[model samples]
Target chain A: MKIGFDAMGGDHAPVETVKGAVDALSLIEGEIVLFGDELKINKELSQYKYDQKRISVVGTTEVIENDDKPVKAIKRKSDSSMVVGMKALRKREVDAFVSAGNTGALLAGSLLKVGRIKGISRPALCTIYPTMSGASVLVDAGANAECKSRNLLEFAYMGSLYAERVIGINNPKVALVNIGAEETKGTPLYIETYQMLKETDLNFVGNVEGRDVPSGKVDVIVADGFTGNIILKLTEGVSLSIVKELKNQIVKNSIGKIAGLLLKRNLGDFKKQLDYSEYGGAPLLGVNGLVVKAHGSSNAKAFMNAIKYAYIGVESNLVAEITEKIKTMPAFEAPVENEEENE
Target chain B: MKIGFDAMGGDHAPVETVKGAVDALSLIEGEIVLFGDELKINKELSQYKYDQKRISVVGTTEVIENDDKPVKAIKRKSDSSMVVGMKALRKREVDAFVSAGNTGALLAGSLLKVGRIKGISRPALCTIYPTMSGASVLVDAGANAECKSRNLLEFAYMGSLYAERVIGINNPKVALVNIGAEETKGTPLYIETYQMLKETDLNFVGNVEGRDVPSGKVDVIVADGFTGNIILKLTEGVSLSIVKELKNQIVKNSIGKIAGLLLKRNLGDFKKQLDYSEYGGAPLLGVNGLVVKAHGSSNAKAFMNAIKYAYIGVESNLVAEITEKIKTMPAFEAPVENEEENE
Candidate 1:
C-alpha cells in the first residue's frame, strides 16, 4: 500500500514530514508518496539514507499557511500539499493521507475532498487523550462545535470502534463526558445523548466527568466538539504548564539542580507518557477514507508516530468497520418526534 | 461581620470546619456562627484555643448527605447545616455562608434560601483558575449548563467584577471562551454574546481558546456553564494526574529516589500553586448572598481558605456590586427582534 504524506504542512513542514516518512519506511511496508515542492522535499530527503524506490516526491507549488481559513484555502489552493494529497486519497492512488498542517484545513479537505462516508452527516476529529490507565479516544475534538443527539450517537460508535480495532481495547467501555456521573447532569443536548447512548449494544459505561477523562476509568468519552475541544486543549495546556513548572522547580537550588541531573531520564519518560505525540496523530474518522491530522507543531518523531497511525488505520480497516457498524446499530429516535408521538 | 459555617458539611465534617473557624479567628474580626449538631461542633471546637466570644454554635437536627438531590434536599432539610446557614445569611445574621459539602445542595440553598440578586436569571459558580501569570476567574463554571446569550453576558460582567474586587486585578481583561479565537467560533449563543460583550465597558479581550486559560493571557474567561464546567474539572483532572505521574517518576530508581528527597521542597511549592485549596473555595456569584463552595475533599486548611474567601466576598460586597453593574450595562440586543424591527 502507498501512503500520501502532506510534506508541506505543520510548523516543521517539508523537513520533518520527509524525515518522518523515511522513519516510517523502517517500521512498515508501505511506499511513501510525499506531496510538496519537489526541491524542498528532495533537499530534506538527501540527508536520510533509504531505498530510493520506497519513497517518491510529487511536486505541488501552493502551500497552505497555518492562518489560512480552512474552507477558503482548500477551495482556492488546488496545488497545495494538503489538497493534492487528499486528491490522491480520493482517486485511490494512495491507501491513506496524513497531514500535520492547519487542522481546520485538513478537516475541511476530509469532508470537501475525500468526502464523508455515505449516510454520515459529519466527520469527527478524534483526539487521543493520555490517562493513568492508558489512553482514551475523544471524538469530535473540534469538528462540530454544536452537535445534535444523533451526531453524538455516531461519535460514540465511531470512537468505540477505533478504541477496539486500532487501539486494541476489547469491548471498550464507552461513556458520555458530562459534569457529573449521574444521567441527570449536562444540558438538554447531553441529557438526550446520554439516554440514547445507554440504549446501544456497545459497552456503555454511563457518564464520565471531566476529572474521569485523565483517570482512564472509561475507554472512550464522547462529547460535542465545543466541549470536547475545550477538554482536549485544556488538558494540553495543563500538561504543558505542569511540565514547565517541573522544569522550573528542578533548577531552584544547588541540591535541586543536582537532583534534576539524576532524575532526567525518568522525567523524560514521564513526559513521554503525558505527550499526545506518542500516540501519533488522531485520525479524522467517519470520513470515506483514512486521513490523520498530526499536531501542527509536530517534530520528526511526532510526524513518524502519525505516519504509523496511517499504517494502523489502513490495516485495521477502521472506516469500513465503522460503516458496517453504522448499518447494524439501532437508529437514534429523534427525541422531539418520539416525545410528540408518545404524548 | 459574621460568617455562617456549615460545620456538618464536607468529607471532613465538624472536625475540619471547627478547626478552620479557629484558624480564621486570629485574622478576622467577624464572629463565626457554626451550624451543625451543637454537641458535635462544641466537642471539636474544644480542642482548638481561640476567643470563645468570636465563635458560636447553632445546633441543627439534620444534615444533607452528599448523594441527595440538590433542590429536593434543600427544600426538605430546613434543619440541615447548609439550609440553616443560608437562612441565617438571608436574615442578615451572617454576612456570608461557606460549605464544603454537597456542591449541588449548597447551590440549591443559595438560590432557594438566600436568593438571587434582582434581575439575575441564574446565579453563577465562579471558579478561580490558577494560571501561570496569576489567577483568572471563570464564571458559570457549573451553574446553568444550557445558557442563552444573555446569560453569558451576565457571567462576563460578574466575572469581571469578582476578578477586580476580590482577586484584585484592576479592570481585569475579560474574554469569551470559544472553540476558536475568532468571534464566529462557537454556537449561535456565543456569537450573539460576543457581539454584546464587545459593546460593554469591560476590559473585553475578545475570544480566548482553552489553552489561553492556563497560559493566563486573560484575567476573566466567561463561558456558558457547559464549556466552563468541562474546562474547570478537566484542569483539575489533568493536574491530579500530573501530580500522580510526578510522584511515580520520582521513585523509579536509587538515583531518582535520592533526587526526590532533595527536590521535595520545590515540588511542594509547585503543588501548592496547583492545589485548589490554596485559593479557598469557588464563589457562587450572581446570588443575593455570598456562598462559597469548598472542595468536597477539603481538609482543615482548605476549609479555612474557603472561609477566607467568604470574608473577601463580603468585604467587597461582590453581590451588591454585580447587581449595580448589571443595571448600568446596556441590554443585549435581541438579534431576531432587532432584525424584525428593522424590517
Candidate 2:
C-alpha cells in the first residue's frame, strides 16, 4: 500500500514530516510518498538513516498556510503539497493521504476534489475523543455547522462503523449528544435525530447529555458540527488549563520540586493519555478516499501517528465498507413529530 | 429586605439550608424567611446560635423530587418549598428567593409563580461562569432550549448588566458564543443575534468560539438555551474529570503523596477559583422576582452563596433594570434573506 504524507504541511514541516515518515516506516509495511519541495525533502531525509527503499518523494512547488482560504487555496495552489497529495489520492496513486495543514483546506480539498462517497450527503470529521473509560468517536467534531436530522443519522452510522472498524470496538454504543437524556430534551434538531436513531439497527442508545461525553457511557457520540465543535474544543481548552495548573502545583518551590521529581513517571503516564499524538489525526469519514486531517501544530511524533492512522483506514477498507452500508440501508425519512419540547 | 430560603430544598436540606440562613444572617443585612416544614426547619436551626429576630419560619407540607417533571411539580406541589417561596416573592412578602433543589422546578416556579418581567419574553438563567481571569456572566445558561433573536438580544442586555452591576466589571465585553469569529460563522439564530447586538449600545464583541469560553476573552457570553446548556454542563463535566484525575495522581504513591502535600495550598487555591460556592448561584434573570437557583448538590456554604447572590440582585434592583432595558429594546426582526445553515 502507498501512503502519501504532506511534507509541506504543519508548523514544523519538511523536518518533522520527513522524520515522522521515516519513523513510521519501521512500524508499517506500506510505502511512504513524501509530497513537497524535493530538495528540502531530500535534505531532511538525508539527516535520517535507513528506510531508503520504502520512501519516495513527489516534488511540489507551493504550500498552504494556516491563513489561506480553504476552497480558494485548493483551487489556486494546485502545486501545493495539500492539493498535490489530495490529487494523488483521487488518482489512486496512493491508498491514503495525510496532512497537518489548514483543516478547512484539507476538508475542502477532500470534498471538492476527491468528492463524496455515493449516497452520502456530507462527510463528517471524526475525532477520537479521550474519555475516562477509554475513548469514543466524536463525529462531525467540526464539519457541518448546520445539519439536517438525516445528516446526524448518517454520522451515527459512520461513527459506529468507525468505532468498530478503524478504532476496533464491536457493536459500539451510539448516542445523540443532547442537552438532556430524556426523549423530549434538546433543540428541534436533536429531538428529531433522537427519534431517528432509536429506530436504527445499530446499538443505538438514547439521548446522552454533554456530561455523559466525558463519563464514557457511550462509544460513539454524534451531533451537528456546532455542538460537536463546542464539546470538542471545550474539552481541549479545559484540559489544557487544568494541565497548566497541575504543572504549576508540581513545581513551584523546593518541596514542589522534590515532589515533581518523585512523581515524574506517573505524570508522564498521565500526560501520555491526554497527548494529541497518542490519538493520531482525525479522519474525514464518508469521503470517497481515505483522508486524515492531522492537527495543524503536530510535531514529528504526531505526524507519524497520523500516517499510522491512515494505514489503519486503508487496511480496514473503511471507505468501501461505509459505501456498502450506505447503499444497503433504507432511505432516510424524518421522524414523525409528536412532542413539541424535548426537555 | 426579606430573603426567602427554601428550607426543604437541596441535597442536604433542612440542615444545610438552615445553616446557610444562619451563615447569611451575619453577612447580609436582611431578614430570612425559612420556608418548609416549620418543625424540621426549626429543629435544624435550634443547634445554631443566631439572632431570633432575623429569622422566621413558614410551614409547607409538599416537596419536589429531583426526578419530578418541572412544570407538573410546580403546578401540583403548591405547598412545596420552591412553590411556597416563589409565591412569597410574587406576593411581595420577600424581596428574593433562594433554592438548591430541582433546577427545572425552580425555573418553572419562577416563571409560573413570579412571572416574567414586563416586556421580557423569556427568563434567562444566569451562571457566573469562572474563567482564567476571574468570572463572567453566562446568560441563558439553560432555561429555554430554543430561542429567537429577540431572546438572545435580551440575554446580552441582562448579562451585561449582571456583569457590571453584580460582578463589578466596568463596561463588560459581551460576546455571542458562536462556531466562529466571522460575521457569517454561526447559524441563523446566532447571525441574527449578532446583527441585533451590533446595533445595541452595550460593549458587544462580535463572535467567540467554544475554546474562547475558558480563555476568558469576553465578559458576557450568550447563546440559546440548548447550546448554553451544553456549554455549561460540558464545562462542569470536563472540569470534574480533570479534578478526579488530579486527585488520583496526588494519592497514588509515596512520592505522589509528598508532592500532594507540598502542592496542597496552590491546588486548594485553584479548586477555590473553580468552586461553585465561590461564584454564587445562578439567578433567573428576566423574572419579575429575583430567584437564585443554587447547585443541586450544594452544601451549607453553597446555599449561603446563593442567598448572598440574591441579596445583591435585590440590592441592585436587577429585575427592575432588566425590565426597563427590555422595554426599550428594538423590536426583533429576523434577517430578511441570508445564509440558511448553522448547526
- Best by the lDDT measure: 1
- Tens-digit lDDT track of model 1 for A1-343: 8888999888887778898989989877879899999999999999989999999999999999988998889889999988999989988899999998888888888877887765566788887888987988999898888799888888999999999998889999999999888898989998999898878898998998887789999999899998888888888888898888888888978888999999989988897898777876888888889998888899888888888878888899988998888875667323321111100
TM-score of 1: 0.94
For model 2 chain A, the run of ten residues with the poorest summed lDDT: A334-343
Q: Per-prediction count of colliding residue pairs?
A: 0, 7
Q: What digit string (tens of lDDT, one per residue) describes model 2 on residues B214-263?
A: 87889999988888888888888888887887678768888788878877
- Candidate 1 backbone clash number: 0
The CAPRI classification for model 2 reads as medium
Please tell me which predicted candidate would have the highest TM-score against the true structure.
Answer: 1
Scored on chain A only, each candidate's TM-score is: 0.94, 0.94
lDDT of 1 by residue, B198-270 (tens): 8889999899888768989899989888788888888988899888888888897888899899998988889
For model 2, the superposed segments whose C-alpha errors exceed 4 Å read: A328-343, B332-343
Question: Where does model 1 exceed 4 Å of error?
Answer: A332-343, B332-343
Error of 1 at A297 (Å): 1.4
